[model samples]
Target: MKKLLYAIAVSATIITGCGKDDEPTPTKVPVEGEITGDITANRTLAFGNYTLKGMVKIQSGVTLTIEAGSTITADKSNGEDGLVVLNGGKLIANGTSDNPIVLTEKSKVAGSWAGIIMYGDAPIVNSATAPAPQVATSEDGLSLTYGGSNAAHNGGSLKFVRIEYAGQVITTNNKEHNGFSFYSVGSGTVLENLVSYKGNDDGFEFYGGTVSGKNLISYGNSDDSFDWQDGWRGQENTNWFAYQTGIGNYGVEVETKGVNNAFWPKVTNITLKRAAGTVTEAQSEIQLDAFQFKANGNGEFSNVVIDGYINQTTPTAFTGGAVQIRDLVTYDNQVLTGKIKITNVKLNNTPTVFIT
Candidate 1:
């Protein structure tokens, strides 16, 4: 398996309401404020139950460390509540399985909030120079630039985190924020044990990044569960996708954007579970392709199990060598997988994103 375990070395300290320290970390400072400049000091946000009200930014050359067991809710009334880690900025959000961190909207509705974005300067295809090392900036209004020769660029650490009711819509098209958007991040970045549930857009989307991920879960996302574009070359492992809603799009959506065709990511031990029914016949179950690859995208899938989806039509644009699609498993003729079996763990009255 292509388990990129070396990407993140996370701490195993779980903190609920009780802390191991004598004096518990003080609470009250909400994630509500503007950061127009650099933050030189190390700040610990006591997730004492507060809501993030607007677009919070971590300026370049700054690190924001989040305390474990903290649940940061998004007040998405204005549709702009989320976190953005700009290039050269870092976010260390390390949460334990028992006391995992949660980011979701107060409304608790999909498409009601924006999500986390990590931008970095790493190597991408057609990168402005010959043999191409193309650099790119974020969408309008973000002003975040990414892509460079630094394969060791460290964006930050995110472990045992859950993002729910996310994926802000930028337009009517598929242009929107993902549950966890990794833009031009490098191999030195850390991503693991992340769950994205009921997102409006894709669950975990990568654009021009080389970061590896593990223990990912995406359920009931409106768009793709996992998506990548713009020359992403990462490795992912132990991902579980449970799409019981017909609104879900692709299990894995691959695309190569701009003038770059270097889309290759190693995916291993994937399990896409859905109800057994004819495609488009079930309103509350999966009804589309489990995997969709286009625009010269490539990936290597090993030990994959796609359950319950009756028909899988590969796009004509997707060809061989671009991706090694192997170990395919589908529905068992007439046997239904029954309802999704998920482990629900609630935190501090916060809605828990269901995990397997």
Candidate 2:
């Protein structure tokens, strides 16, 4: 009887242990070498003599870290685009000033890839009401949706980066793409010490968001030096220098035609020397228009210097209404030497007073 009781207890123990073992145990699948080709993410991707052919989409919550001196050349020979589309993803491109991250074409000449397009899910102009903002798609007559959130969006950072000879396509009827295009980027993102050299289009173009930046340099760009469109409320502290051979339309262009009427961009400590080309006979300089401000609303400016060579071709340097100017204050030698017009300005030695 004792032997049988002992055997039954052993059997019960064995059965219980077996039942526990039968329960499913979670196992971690190792994704060691999952990435196959160019379009890859969520893993460390190395570029060695590799050509980024098509649009590379970096998904959200993932970090794409580019090492120093890693030349990610965009293949512009083909109709395909070499772009890094940041769909709420993070790009930690911490390039040093000595060796900046180069985004250029296969050819040594100008006009290369479509440029770096960063799309965030932030509140753009008319984001709540208008249709979702769309980007260029590979298929004909198709576009990708991006940007829309009530809360503040955080994309990532672009620091000590340089884009050379970029921006080829005229994406829209009136506006061309820029060297560094920030589409619907939010205030959470950080951009600083950026250089756009010899780009065919604008140096830095902001579509719509509350993104503030500083220490931006644009040398020999064809289009406008700095452009703001679709209700961008950001503070900028920059040094703008243009060359005479450079075919830039305007020094600073602001066009806000969508929602958010109160478009106030505070600009301070800007040094603009236009028409610095090798040819001295031509006079290429800064030009301002109120069409953008009128379409949106008035703007505010302070401590800005517009220095340009004046000649026959150069129209009135500055043309805008005083009502377009809100709290307009000027310091450190605000002199309009050439054929210029100041509608309503309050000139003060130190503290600026209202003209009204």
Candidate 3:
């Protein structure tokens, strides 16, 4: 068990009132019957509470649709509770803004379970366990093999939901799981208004996928708020605050793999903020490059408002190399003729490179 927190002390702060002290959480009466193994048909998780005790793989020919205001709890005693949507599987989890569906842990602690994994047949370059096309299950220490020719493949719908306390490092090889791991998921899916909190790993991560998203929020999480890799053409529509609690690591950490391929994602209408805390707390404890874009990732970050950062230049704003450093005027096809509208930030050190 490779816990990322080795005495990582963090003050318990509420983000969206999910596990906050001011919110009234619903009690979960653990479902007795097992919802494990491969789901066979169209199963609708109606207004009720359920528990998943083991590995659940939604077989290809089925649609697992979860209704609004539904709460699904998990008990990770032996680290088995995980939801995997296969290549051809479809999920329709449509929760509203007021009554969003919530998937939480029984203990309500961070690093509870493996996490939700969405797999598809997208395109990729090279993989350690996968041979470009015919990828093996040994790649990510699990059975979610990703990559294909279809760029518009639809895995399912994960909208208006709160995924809390997932991303448990199950095994030594299984430490990379996030709250929502989109592995080769395509664009024909629906991922909107998704929120992840208090997870031990990244709130959301994309591994060689082309799926876009909207209205994503993460708070108090132990890792990056958003992470993407493997030539992803992510087109996020809109976003809220990129808040950081005492346990949060980064706001956005994007990597282009060792290939350093020139790939970009369109991120629009967002505000990045680091919550105020002690000098040695979350916001101030950011690394040399907190919001680093590794492997020369090119993307359009337009209409971004940054606030509440102690020293903007200490942990450099955007740090990464690029094969072709486009002009600051043009990014991800949007023409940004002005600055990123940085306000409320206390800049001490002279700034280095930004948006290249």
* Overall lDDT per candidate, in order of appearance: 0.63, 0.51, 0.64
List RMSD in Å for every model shown: 11.0, 19.0, 9.3
For model 1, how does the per-residue alpha-carbon lDDT over 1-356 read when each residue is reduced to its tens digit?
12221112354565568557668667556444322233455566765555676677787888888877777888766557778888888999888766677787888888876788888877776332446467776752465666777777798899988888887776434466788888888888888878888788788888877888878887777777888877777855455444535556556766554233323577767765544332232344332556654544456666666644433323222111111222121111101131111122112211212111
Judged by whole-model lDDT over C-alpha atoms, candidate 2 comes out at 0.51
Q: For each candidate, what TM-score against the reference?
A: 0.71, 0.66, 0.74
* lDDT score for residue 302 of model 3: 60
Native-structure RMSD, model 2? 19.0
How many Å off is the CA of 102 in candidate 3?
0.6
Mark the regions of model 1 whose C-alpha exceeds 4 Å error after superposition: 1-41, 126-131, 140-143, 171-174, 236-244, 258-263, 276-287, 311-356
Give residue 161's error in model 3 in angstroms: 0.9
lDDT comparing candidate 3 with the true structure: 0.64
Best by TM-score: 3
Q: Worst ten-residue run, lDDT, model 1?
A: 327-336
- Residue 289 Cα positional deviation in candidate 2, in Å, after optimal superposition: 7.2
